[model samples]
Every structure is written in structure tokens, then in C-alpha cells.
Target: MTAPASLRDHAYQTLKRRIVEVQLRPGARLVERDLAAELDVSRIPLREALRMLAAEGLVLLVPAKGALVATFSPADVRDLFDIREVLESLAARLAAERATPDTLAPLTHRMAEARTATVSGDLRRIAAANAAFHAEIIAMAANPLLSNVMGPLAARTEWLFRLTASRDPVEQCSEHEELYGHIASGAADEAATSAFAHIAAGRELSITLAEKWSDPDFDPELIARGRRRRRVES
Candidate 1:
């Protein structure tokens, strides 16, 4: 049977969303046959979808065993946060300059939703709402380059933020609310600074937790496998 034109596109987006949403955890092996069946697509198109994720650094292609979700080291998370600080700082500044009532309204709604979701004790909804809030704010900058620069970093940081579910949600909700207030009020520098502080605080907390409760029995072979894939890709 000939594949539909949207077959590969659907697989690519489905896999990417799953990866970014952390449904596919880091170092989790992806079985091709299972993925094909799950996606209701042929293995041929699924392979292309995997390649797309590899290019974006969301999935790693092992030499023989094929692809798995990419893992984050503390070092990797730190590097990502550093990049995010720079890119998002610029985004905040531009968003301040470019923001309109129309644009900011959606962000405001999401921000409020985020706070309510946190209070309602719905971790998954809070996570989704939080992501939506920040994403819409960044989008106000209207610069493709800025969004492109921050996308992967944001994606990688999400797993760390998931740790927040176990901690205080009000703190996070408050942080975003304050940042959004600054953006809405056209306090450009204030918004940017607050954004940085928010991200930095999360980075610090996540780093500490990662150290305290790190995986005790990590797979050395997996690390080597990841390293070899990097070498080949390079």
C-alpha cells in the first residue's frame, strides 16, 4: 500500500511531541517495530521520523541498536540554561518592544491558568499550562531566530522542571505570574531580569536534586554508545 502524504509528517510530529513532552524519557530505548505499530505507520516512514529527531538532538542513534531518547547531564542542563538565559533575555526585550494588547492577552490567560493548575494540584496540567505561558510570551518577540535558538534548550530543561512536581508549585506559579506582570506592564528590563532569575533558580534547584538523587547504577555502555554516536555524527 502506498503511504499517505501525511504519513511521515504525522509520525515525525507525533514522535517529536512525545519526546519534548517527556513521554519518551532520556535513555529509553525505542523499538522500531513497536513504534511503527504505535504510530500506525510503516517502518520506512518511522525511520525518517527518527532521523528528524536525531537532527534536533532529541533522540540519539546508536551504532547498531538504533535510536533512544537523549539524556541530560548536569553539565548539559547547565549549558542549556546558559544559552536560554541569553536567548530568552533577548526575546523578553523584543517582546516588550513589540507586545500589543492582542498578543499579551493570550499569554496572560495561560499564565493565570498555570497558577490555577498548580493550585488545583494537577501536575500534568500545570506543566502544560506553564509551558504554554512562557512559550507565548517568547513568541511575542516575533523573531524566528530567537525562538529557534531557545527551542532545544527549552526542550532539554523540561525534564528538570518535572522534578518541581515534588516541590513547591506555588513558588513556580508565583515566579511566572510576576514575570508575566512585568511583561504586560511593559517593564522590559524588569521582565527580563525576572525571567532570568526564575530560570536560574529552577536550574539551581534541579541541579541540586540531580546531584542528591542521581541514578546510582548508570549504564557505562550507554554513555559509550552515546559518545560513539556523537563522534559519528560529528
Candidate 2:
């Protein structure tokens, strides 16, 4: 049998999922005692998990009041996408200039996985596969410095992808395929352009959704309902 998960790991994963899915609303207080009881763990593991989430930028550790879910604003979305555009475009360019078919196999695999996930209407899987595809591109780019810079942002990027899950995953997969083709053909300029276009296409929509989700009065239940509706529609 598989080994049981550690309390800290379980708590971290559970809290992270709740936060990413908006079950734990942004700017809401996270009481240690309540969370500890809810998760059926002692305060030690709960606090450890909170610290981990804080490091990933999903939770804020206040000096006196305790932890709060991290908030996102439209400006924050734009800022993140701006950074992604520049860095990801450069990564695609480098990958195009350096990648071979073998080097790009991981991206191709991720693209296929994303397509399957989209068709199956698994939003979480789609986000994860899409993130993996990007990670592969960064790795294929062969720049350690770039990878190091991007490593910390992977979790945040996946979080953003989930918030914008209303977007057509099919279209996103298609764009990933196109970018892959450019990289495989060693067309550096085309690959860079494709990367920028892909990221830009989602930027405005993400900002709009962020505005709605970040509103103080917004209902978290709506996020779940929307995902269910999208699943049916897809």
C-alpha cells in the first residue's frame, strides 16, 4: 500500500486547492484554530502548511492578525501577464533556435494531454497540462537563469490559468500546438510571435475575470457553478 501523506503535506495541498479554487476567498482571514480543527490536524502542521502557502504567494502572513488569502486585482493580473509575455516570448524564441524534435517531445506530450483534458472537460487537468507545456518550453530553452527566475512563478501561473478556466481550452491547446510547430521547425521569430500572441489573447479576459472574482461581494459559489456549467457545455 502507498504510504500515508504527512499532515503538513496534506494540509498544504488542501489549503492550496481551496485557495486556488476560491473556496477560501481572497482577503478572508485564516484562523489557525479553526483551520486546524477543520483539517483534523494539530496547529503545528497547519502552521507549517500556512507558511508553505505563504511562500508560494497564495497566503499572506500578517504580523499580528494571522494569515489571509492573497488578493488579486486587475492591475495584478496585468502585471503578471506582462512579465509572462516578455519571459515566455524569450523562452519560445530560444527554444525555436535550439530545440530539436527530441527536445520538444515533452511539449508535444503535454499538448496531447491538454487536448484530452479539454475534451474531457477537466479544468484542473487542463491548467496543469498547459502549465507543464510552458515549463517544458522553458527547460528546452536551455537557460538556467531563465528557469530559475520562472520557477517561483509556476504555481501562480497555474492559479491564473484556473481563474480563467471559462476560456475555451480547445483554443488554448491549438495555440500550444502552433507554438510547438514553430519551435520544432526552428523558426525563432515565428515561435516568439506565437508565444506573445497566445499570452496576449488571454491577458484581457483574465483581467476582466480577475476584476469580478476579486470583488469583495463576489460569491465563491459562483466560481464552482461556472466550472460545472462549463463542464456541461464542453
Candidate 3:
């Protein structure tokens, strides 16, 4: 028989999922007492789980206020995007060179599904589809090093993509189509260039629109701390 999962493992995965799915936005408080009671586990396991997430850059610790989700300011947004640009450029280049027809087919399916999901405007499916698209490409790169490099950054990248999706989503989907074509044509450098620009544009849009999402409920402390990005509002 399979052994039961540990409490700390359960707590870690549940909390991580909640944060990545934006149920716990950046700077959203994680009240230990409330969470332990709600999760029906003792504080010990919950605290342990939180410590794990903190190491992963998903949760933040405070001297007195407990842990909250980590907030991204304009600088953080650009830095993360710059790193992804480097990593993804390499991934795209390698995928084009290394991907067989069998490998390419899966990525094509993933992108097509993502495009369909985007056209339908179902945010939940869009999130899943987007992950599938990126993951398929990452896998096609056939580099263990790329996956190792991305393991820690994956959660934050997903959060950033969700933020990007909230902005000019149609443009984002169209870029994915262009990327698909470039990769299909065996243009590694071209695909890399297009993917880099697409990702960079999304990152810029996320930072520029960051203030519009701030409110008392979403993240009061960050709302107070973040300078408005100054985009024209409709």
C-alpha cells in the first residue's frame, strides 16, 4: 500500500497552489491561526510548509506579521522578465534545433489549445493552456539544464503570465501563434527573438498596469508602497 502523504507536504502544495492561482495575491496575509484551523492541521506542519515556500520565493516572512506572498514592483518585474528572456531564448533555440516531428507535434497541439482557450476567454482554461504551451516548448529544448534552471522560477513566471493575461490578452495570443510558425519553420534564432520580444512586452505591460490592480482588499500594504505606473485608463 502507498504511504499517506505528510501533513507538511499537503500544506505546502495547497498553499503554493492557492498563491500561484492568485487566491493569495502578492502581499496577501497568511494568518497562521486561521490557516491551521481551516486546513485542519496543527500549526507545526503549516509553519514548516510556509518555510519551504519561503525558500522557493513564493512566500515572504516578516519579523512580526507572519508570512505573506512576495510583492513585485516595477524593478522586480523587469528583472524577472530579463532572466526569462535569456532562459527562454536558449530554450527556443534549442527546441528548434533538437525537436523531432514527434516533439514538435505536441508543442503544436499545446499552442493550438492555448489559442482556442484564449479565444473563448475562460481565464481558468487560459491559465492551464498557457502553462501547457510553455511547458511543451521547454520540454522540446531537450536540455536537463533548462528545466533545472527554470524549476525555481516557474511559480513566479506563472504568476507573471497570469498578470500579463489580464492585460492586452489578444496580442499575447497572437504572438504565441507567430512563435508557433517560426518554430515550425526551423528558425531557431528567429523564434528565440520573437519569443524574447513577446515575453518582454508582456512584462512591460504587467508593470505598467500594476497600479490599476491595487486596492485595499488586493494588497493594502503594497497598494500603499507601490508607485502608480501611470497608464491611461479607459
Stretches of candidate 3 off by over 4 Å are: 1-6, 63-65, 212-234
TM-score of 3: 0.82
Tens digit per residue, CA lDDT, model 3, 103-198: 899998998898898889987668768767877778888899888888788777777666556765577788888988888888998989988987
Mind giving the per-residue lDDT tens digits that candidate 2 earns over 141-171? 9999999999878878888888888999989
Best by lDDT: 2
User: How high is the lDDT of residue 27 in model 3?
Assistant: 70
RMSD (Cα, Å) of candidate 2? 7.0
CA-lDDT, candidates in order: 0.71, 0.82, 0.75
What ranking emerges by TM-score with the best candidate at the front? Answer: 2, 3, 1
True-structure Cα RMSD, model 1: 5.6
Which pairs of residues collide in candidate 2? none
How many clashes in candidate 2? 0
Model 2 off-target regions past 4 Å? 1-6, 216-234
